[model samples]
Target: MAMPTIKAVRAYTVRGGGADYHDTQGYHWIDDHIATPMARYEEYRQSRRSFGINVLGTLVIEVEASDGTVGLGVTTAGEIGAFIVEKHLSRFLIGRQVTEIEKIWDQMYFATQFYGRKGVVVNTISGVDIALWDLLGKLRGEPVHALLGGPVRDELQFYATGARPDLAKEMGFIGGKLPLLHGPAEGDEGLKKNIEKLADMRSKVGDDFWLMYDCWMSLDLNYSIKLAQKAQEFGLKWIEECLSPDDYWGYADLKRNVPKGMLVTTGEHEATRWGFRMLLEMDCCDIIQPDVNWCGGITELIKISALADAHGKLMVPHGSGVYSYHFVITRHNSPFTEIIMSAPNADEVRPAFSPLLLDEPVPVNGRMKASALDKPGFGVRLNPEVKLHRPYAAA
Candidate 1:
């Protein structure tokens, strides 16, 4: 039995998932002068044929081992990730043993430090890091959770993130997290509408099932606190990413100001342990939600979770398909998991990354049995029918 050496690293830019595939109905990323909520902007943009939702466009990375095992990973980096993997990061991985993940991660991070400690660059590193984990899991003939010290719990309970908490309740999810449709620029009426929407959802879902808001990094300190204070009457469980991920002081202020018993959570957009340290040390948030794809992959997540646990905070990773599920089950601190309800109205349960992932796991009655993920590696493969565009190839 010999160790498998990485032979090549390839990046695939994949497209096509029909009209409903993109998660574009949330926040708008453009500058404030032109920025508007996605819903309002999308209609006009569509009419002009000048823009379309490209959020679903994915950059998938495949790391091939000398023994013919190919491990798969994906991210939101689009073509930029493809370029990083094919041209830069691949050099660090091409001949290394798959088991040297930490060393490889360090080299990749430091090598790219001058240009990338976060954002698309970290996203690029994430895709590669995940592929390496998938590779190692396959070589060892074990599921990723087993490699991460096995499950601490027998099953994973889930909450849904979508438009309809009522539908999520019917599907047996423990809670439903809705997107805040407006931001600070929307004014006082917008704040009223935000609370009104939560109140309406609270009336529908009733008092027992938890309801929370995914503010999506779109609120200011004053607006978030106002929204949180109003939302408390409706039993909001937490205000998530209400302020920018970088606003540690604002987060700390919000945490202190929010009505007691309502938690403040963030970090879905934050990257690396150093970034998360600011959140934890400042007592900025009660819970930390790191997206594995964007938060430096599972390697960094392990470190982040340990830090959260040390601080007595919950490490509920923002949903990223089975990648997060595998990590969630292995840790005690991650009490539950999140499922991105794919049904247009959040009425039906479907794999979050449907069409993109073959053999993807879905929760049964808001719970995922541990046995469901028993397959080797991440237990998933790229949907063969989907076209993968390899813009760059290693030499």
Candidate 2:
């Protein structure tokens, strides 16, 4: 059989689930008087329904091959990704072979360098790159992990990222990472409350279950150290993204300052190998968390992972649905995966990218068996119920 060539690339901005989408922006709590990290938590505790999860939406990418096999991918890019895909990226991919992923990725990167080295441009590239991977997988009749060199493990252990570690523990997740609500501007009281929140969670989940904080690029070096120091008393597993992704020196300093046992991790916002090279070479973090969707997709993630492995750093991708799962199961260094608790109160273990993906695999008893993802490509489809807004259609 002849290899299938890429026929067209399509981008869609889709409105996913209503309440359960978990928009990160909606969680930001800024109060002048309250002035504490726990303010958001307290607010959430009091009025869960009032803080409605408004849809920030998603960008879905579809790559069609000559044989009519369509492979799907998605990201948080929204209309921006759709524009890039339909206007700029579609031209490079339309007549190329589906197997030319690396070359295509390079072309996309260099072509967009004037206007796009990071941020939404990389995100747009990521969606297209993932679609290309999916396209190739379908054309070859293999799952993505198998194409990446087969699974090194039989099952993938999971940690949850959400508001409720207690609920996550009950659901069989190994650990739960809570988002840090207050930034440096909140002052010393906020720092105390941040530690207090972790302490409260520790009391509920117990010391045996792993507990971590996702600072979400909201803290300064001094605040992070104080929080980490206090967190040590509660046996906190790690402190993630305490500073901006660009602060390599700060990360190095924070890594050295934290308690001996705890780990320092970052890079959920950083992109590509060059971005990660700074993290590894600076010896800034113990673990690197690259989102496969945001960090240039599977092709770039492989490169990023290899660099982390070379440096003896763990490559735990940020929770990005099935896209991360396939890559996690295949790599020895990844060790485990992350699942974002999509339940309203973070009380239930729903599929990570719920209502957006039709057939996403959820972890069973804190683990996803390899069999769940054995289907060709990424093993999921875009939910047809979503209202897709195609910004630009090719001729």
Off by over 4 Å in 1: 17-56
**Candidate 2 lDDT, tens digit per residue, 309-370?**
99999999998878998999889899998987776567777876767787888898899899
Looking at model 1, which ten-residue stretch has the lowest summed lDDT?
28-37
Candidate 2 TM-score, C-alpha based = 0.91
TM agreement with the true structure for every prediction:
0.92, 0.91
lDDT of model 1 at position 27: 34
Q: What is the lDDT of candidate 2?
A: 0.83
* Candidate whose TM-score is highest: 1
lDDT of each: 0.84, 0.83
Q: Write the per-residue lDDT of candidate 1 for residues 291-346, one digit (tens) a residue.
A: 89988988999999999999999999988879999999999999998987766556
Over 4 Å off in model 2, which ranges?
17-56
